[model samples]
Target: MKQQDNRALGAWSRSSTAVLAAVAIALFGAAAWHLGTVALSVAPPNTLSRHYPRWIADHIHPELEQNWKLFAPDPPQGNGQIEARVRTVNGTGARHTAGWTDLSASDIAAVRSNLLPSRTDQDLLLYAWDYYALWHDQLPGHPREARLMAANLKRTALQRLMPQYQGQRITGLQFRFRFDRVPPPSWASPTTTDRPVNQVLPWWRVQNKDCQGL
Candidate 1:
């Protein structure tokens, strides 16, 4: 009878140990799952600006307030105000003459369009072109130095603009910077030679519009 009792106690102890082991495993699994969920919920730091446009404007226009203070004293009255004229590809033009402190959504949209890839590679190509133009004007007839300056400007502009966003999806459209020499056929005089050509060598033209107006 004593031998049978010992056998029953041994069986109970073994079963209890097995049950505890299973419980421990389940608890551990639940804890691991909870930790993983918390990790996924947390967003990566500095992936995106808290206020994207304001942040961008701050970076782009650091002396904006100072400039406004200087210029606001003699604010342009009525239709004589400094106006931003946006010329679209379709020959339509829209004008905005709001104060610098009051930038409307339309103004922001127009600015964004200038930087956008679909409209033009303004961030990359235009930056390089403008730099080349400025450098060439400063030191005329120096192709090697002009090329180096343009390249450096391009690299700096890309570094400033091409920031990686965590949740934002980057498409092939965003990466596109391929420039075509073909001008739109709707121009008044469409000639093969009249189309704007990418100068193999940077040359300063007096007719070039000042990009600082942006």
Candidate 2:
């Protein structure tokens, strides 16, 4: 009876080891599947990605995907601004300029001091503007792309400033974006010879009927 009990104990130990091995393999496979999705999302398109296009669509489509080079090739050297001019029809029904509002400064000031600093919160608009500038007739081939970029910039800007126009009847609104290049470090001569270049975007007429369409 003692010999039979020992043999049964040995069999139980082997069974437990086999179960643990299977669990480990399953966990590893799960981890690898997620890692593959991430790898395919960011990596450049390849033959494998082409084959598994449906998988990427279901997993990491453009809306949910990310790109690395936001300020790439060469980073902007200077400061940037997105100033908004709001024209409102006052009580007399005459259109008057309500002065220029500096929307960019408000965004920069928000993220200057924070316990938990996030990149997407701080730079999404800033990058969106940059992206718009790059595509908007700068390269001179992508009219549709430029239009989409402009729409995105306008959408973000409007969302930020809509609260300020509570009581005012804003008839016209325009956004101007500026990007300045910084000078390289010269130990002997630190002054920049280059003047600031401004890319003034065309004025957009706002319509309450369809602000999203604007």
lDDT per model vs. reference: 0.39, 0.72
Task: Tell me the lDDT of model 2 at 72.
Answer: 57
Candidate 1, position 143, lDDT: 60
Which 10-residue window in model 2 sums to the lowest lDDT?
Answer: 57-66
Alpha-carbon TM-score of each model against the true structure = 0.21, 0.58
- Would you list the clashing residue pairs of candidate 2? 77-182, 78-180
Global lDDT of model 2: 0.72
Task: Please provide, for model 1 over 1-214, each residue's C-alpha lDDT reduced to its tens digit, 9 standing for 90 to 100.
Answer: 9999999999999999999999999999978754543433333443343334334333322122122335556531211111111111212333222122211233345567764435343334344544555656764655655666654543433333223322222121111122234443575575445333233332221111222222
lDDT for each residue of candidate 2 in 23-78, tens digit (9 for 90 to 100): 99999997887678779877889987879866764565324555666655555568
Q: Per-residue error at 44 for model 2, in Å? A: 12
Report the number of the highest-lDDT candidate.
2
Q: Count residue pairs with overlapping backbones in model 1.
A: 0
